[model samples]
Target: MNFQNRKQLIVQTVDERGSVDVRELAELLQTSEMTVRRDLVQLAASGLLYRTRGGAMKVSLATDQFRFANKTAVNADRKDYICQLAAQDVQEGDILFMDCGSTVFRLCPFIRNKRITVITNSLPVVAELMSSDVTVNLVGGEVDKERQAVHGLMAEEHIARYRANRAFIGVDGISLQHGLSANSEKEASTATAMARQTEKVYLLCDSSKLETDKYLYFAPLSLFDVLITDTEAKPDVVAAYRKAGIRLIN
Candidate 1:
């Protein structure tokens, strides 16, 4: 199998069986033990799995809280501040498309009382808005266990069926060169679908993501109606974005 396909299968195997023995993986993949070892090392380095003596294991919450908690803990206050800034633009009776971004999730508490309809793929977003005044439409798809979100073809199709006034999205990285990007195709596709179906798009990104680029570029800076960030953002960086015609609300 190709590296990408092998990688996905490796991750799925760990998710399904809770762990993967090197010999078993090699047999299942029809590759060598060395290939399995190399794959395990790469996955472990990427925080996708825990490397064991002769195999690898799933990255459960207890082990590391996976990427979701680890990412949330990083610049938690900054993320909240960015979200608060984004919340200022929200209006009553608006329909919003929220993505499965930790920063986007923070906007939930601030917008709880607004009579808004939220169309989202985030499990956390749906959970937070469950008892609120906001009406939620969760897209149908496979649950991404680690990210606590729904993704895949069905989710994209569901998102395409609805239109929104505003889409509050997140990015793994952003840059003038590569635009707004995500670490995985599933995330990129979902965000792209939301942006395509929304009238205006708001990017909720922290200062740290400025000028950085990730694996998949889904949208350009021009796609956003406004970029909301925390006050910690550098003046020059904000100026650069504004100069490039990206409206900023920091």
Candidate 2:
């Protein structure tokens, strides 16, 4: 393929997969590994893909980051069910904490007029619940445009003041070994603090995240009171969490 055609293909691959493995790229492009590396460098320089250790990642608000919109599309239906199950645990007048994430966003639709107090860092969640009787407080701080979540030291301070009866949170990956993880350290810190402030922590995760590791670690699965997932979840992974004394729900 010509240089222009090859570059387009590389960009397209990363766009579709969110990331591209270098070895796979070389094989697909029928080129040497060195040539693929050169192409990736050019793409990175041109504000296209961001080159990582063994691959290239798509560009987003945070460079090489995934946005909430993209995430909401992944395993959407399963996330909805998990969110539905989470909402059943709420009681009237309960002070709840919801983190900014696609899975948690699903809970907003199910939370009707419960006369509950909700403190959250997610913009979408606040917007969804605006008309409901639920008293929603937006945690103020610098907004993370990509995740559509408010996070930073200022937000963290506000979250520390109130203890929550329950905290519903999500993570980029849920590993039995590594605990919770997110793409950004700031996001992870906000989530970790929210979990600590709550009497009970419920994690909403799709099957895809089970046993997967990410760049930043939030907390171990043992720290969570329960995990709500979908039926597609791997049995072994669920068993691992169950063995750790964590309640797993589908």
Candidate 3:
């Protein structure tokens, strides 16, 4: 194949699998490994992919220097602020259930120094806290590649076996009218399971996710003990949530 075809194929592989292996690309294109590396360098320079020691990763996956690729990268600063607010609720020696939501993943950094145990279904969460003071228990189940988490009947059952002091979760949309909804039912089920076994549930969402609705409704607003969002939340909207008896920490 020509150089253009090889380059396109390399990009396609990364887009499909989230990362590309240099050896695999060389074999697939019947080219030298050096040639593949050169192409990866150009792609990385163009911001199409990120070069790793062994391969190239999707651009979004490199946003946080993690394995999971999330669209929340667009509003990264806002999400970090939101998660920092949520992290305040965590105390030492607490058992927590962390979700796969990008917003929830942001919580890892803030609480890494705390002495606590975390039960989660997110692969990114595991990678984030692997070298930290927090102990991680990953739920076993079918992998959801797009979300970079695990969710299924097995995952829900696994979550049921453990109880936590707090559960930090994310949602596609959350509002008083629609409650909590998600674009993926499998993910919704995992969230429900986590909340069910937790003493308190904190919903970590940004302003854009507030006052919106998705198709699959999972839990109601009543399930959450607190809603932590960024400063972008409007005064009246914050008041509405407070009036509904849901606490807000911003």
TM-score of each: 0.74, 0.76, 0.72
Higher TM-score: candidate 2 or 3? 2
Clashing pairs in 2: none
**All candidates: CA RMSD (Å):** 11.0, 5.3, 12.4
Model 3 whole-model lDDT (C-alpha atoms): 0.84
| Model 1 per-residue lDDT tens digits across residues 1-250 | 9989999999998776454568768868999999999999999999999886567767773285335755565567888888887888889999999999888988899999999999999998899999999999999999999888999999999999999999999887788888888768988899889999999999898876777666677777777788888897778888988888888888
Report the C-alpha lDDT of model 2 over 98-141, residue by residue, as the tens digit: 99878888898888678899999999899889999899988989
On the 0 to 100 scale, the lDDT of residue 18 in model 2 is 65
Question: 186 in model 3: Cα distance from truth in Å?
Answer: 0.9
Error of 3 at 12 (Å): 27
Candidate 2 shows a clash count of: 0
Q: Which ten residues in a row have the lowest lDDT in candidate 2?
A: 58-67
Candidate 1 pairs with clashing backbones = none
Off by over 4 Å in 3: 1-68
